[model samples]
Target: MDESTGLTIHKSEAVALTQNGGLAKAIKPLTKEIHLFDTYVAGVSYLKDKTVLQEIKIKDRLTLQREDNKFDDKAIVVLSSDGKKLGYVPEKDNIIFSRLMDAGKLLVAYIIEIKKRSIDYQQISIGIYLVDF
Candidate 1:
C-alpha cells in the first residue's frame, strides 16, 4: 500500500502506478481506487476492424458494464472510452466481478498492456479496480 495516497499495490504492476503518472492525478479528488484483478480483454478477434485495437494505449481508462441478460448471466462487457464494445471480461473471470456490481459497487478498468502477436492479432490486457468515493 502507498502511504502517501492510501492506494493498495498488488503485484509488481502496481509499481507502474508511480512510473505511469499515478492514478490519483488522473481521477477526481476524494475518489479512492483498489486494484482488483488483471486480465486480457477476451474476444478481440470478433471485432470488425482489428486495427481499432491499435488505438488503445497503456494507462488508458476503460469501462465495465454488467450485461445481466447476456448468455452468461455473469457477463460484463468491456468498453472503450468512446463506448465501443471491446469484449467481455472472460466468462471465467466475470462471476465475482458481476456479484460485486450486483451489490452496487462501482468497478472500472484501465489498459495495462497491449501485445501484438501477428498482423491480425493483438491482445489488450486491463487492470480492474474497485472505486470508492
Candidate 2:
C-alpha cells in the first residue's frame, strides 16, 4: 500500500500495479529498495552558484535536513553533494517529503535539470528518490 496515492499494490502484482496507474508507476526496483518519486527545489538565493547549477551531475546524491528556524513547520533544507547549502524543498511539495525524511526513510535527491528563470524558486530543480529498508 502506497501512502501518497492510497493505492494498495501487492508485491506479486507490481507489474500490473504500474500498468494500473499509481505510485507504482513512479517506482522502479533497484536492489532491495524501491526508487520512488522525485522532489524539486526552491529558494534559489541560498544556492552556491545559480549560474553553474546545470553543471551538477544528474544522479549525484544530495542531503535533506529539517529546518525550523525561519520557514514552515515542514521546512526541509536541500544540500549539495559536498555538503554545501543548495536551497530547499518547495513549500507546496515539502509536506510529505519532509515527513518522510524526518521519519528516517532513505530519501535521496539528485540534480535533474536546472532552468534559468527570473524567479528564484523557478531556478533549479532537484530529483528525489526514496529507498526503504
Top-TM-score structure, candidate number: 1
TM-score of 2: 0.61
Off by over 4 Å in 2: 1-33, 46-55, 118-122
Model 2 over residues 18-41: C-alpha lDDT tens digits? Answer: 665654445545324355656567
lDDT of 1 by residue, 12-124 (tens): 75566656667666456769899999998988888875655767788989999998654798999998888788888999999999999999999999999888877777788
lDDT of candidate model 2 versus the reference: 0.70
| Candidate 1 structure lDDT | 0.86
TM-score, structure 1 vs. true? 0.74
Clashing pairs in 1: none
In candidate 2, the residue pairs with backbone N, CA or C atoms under 3 Å apart (3 or more residues apart, or in different chains) clash, namely: 39-128
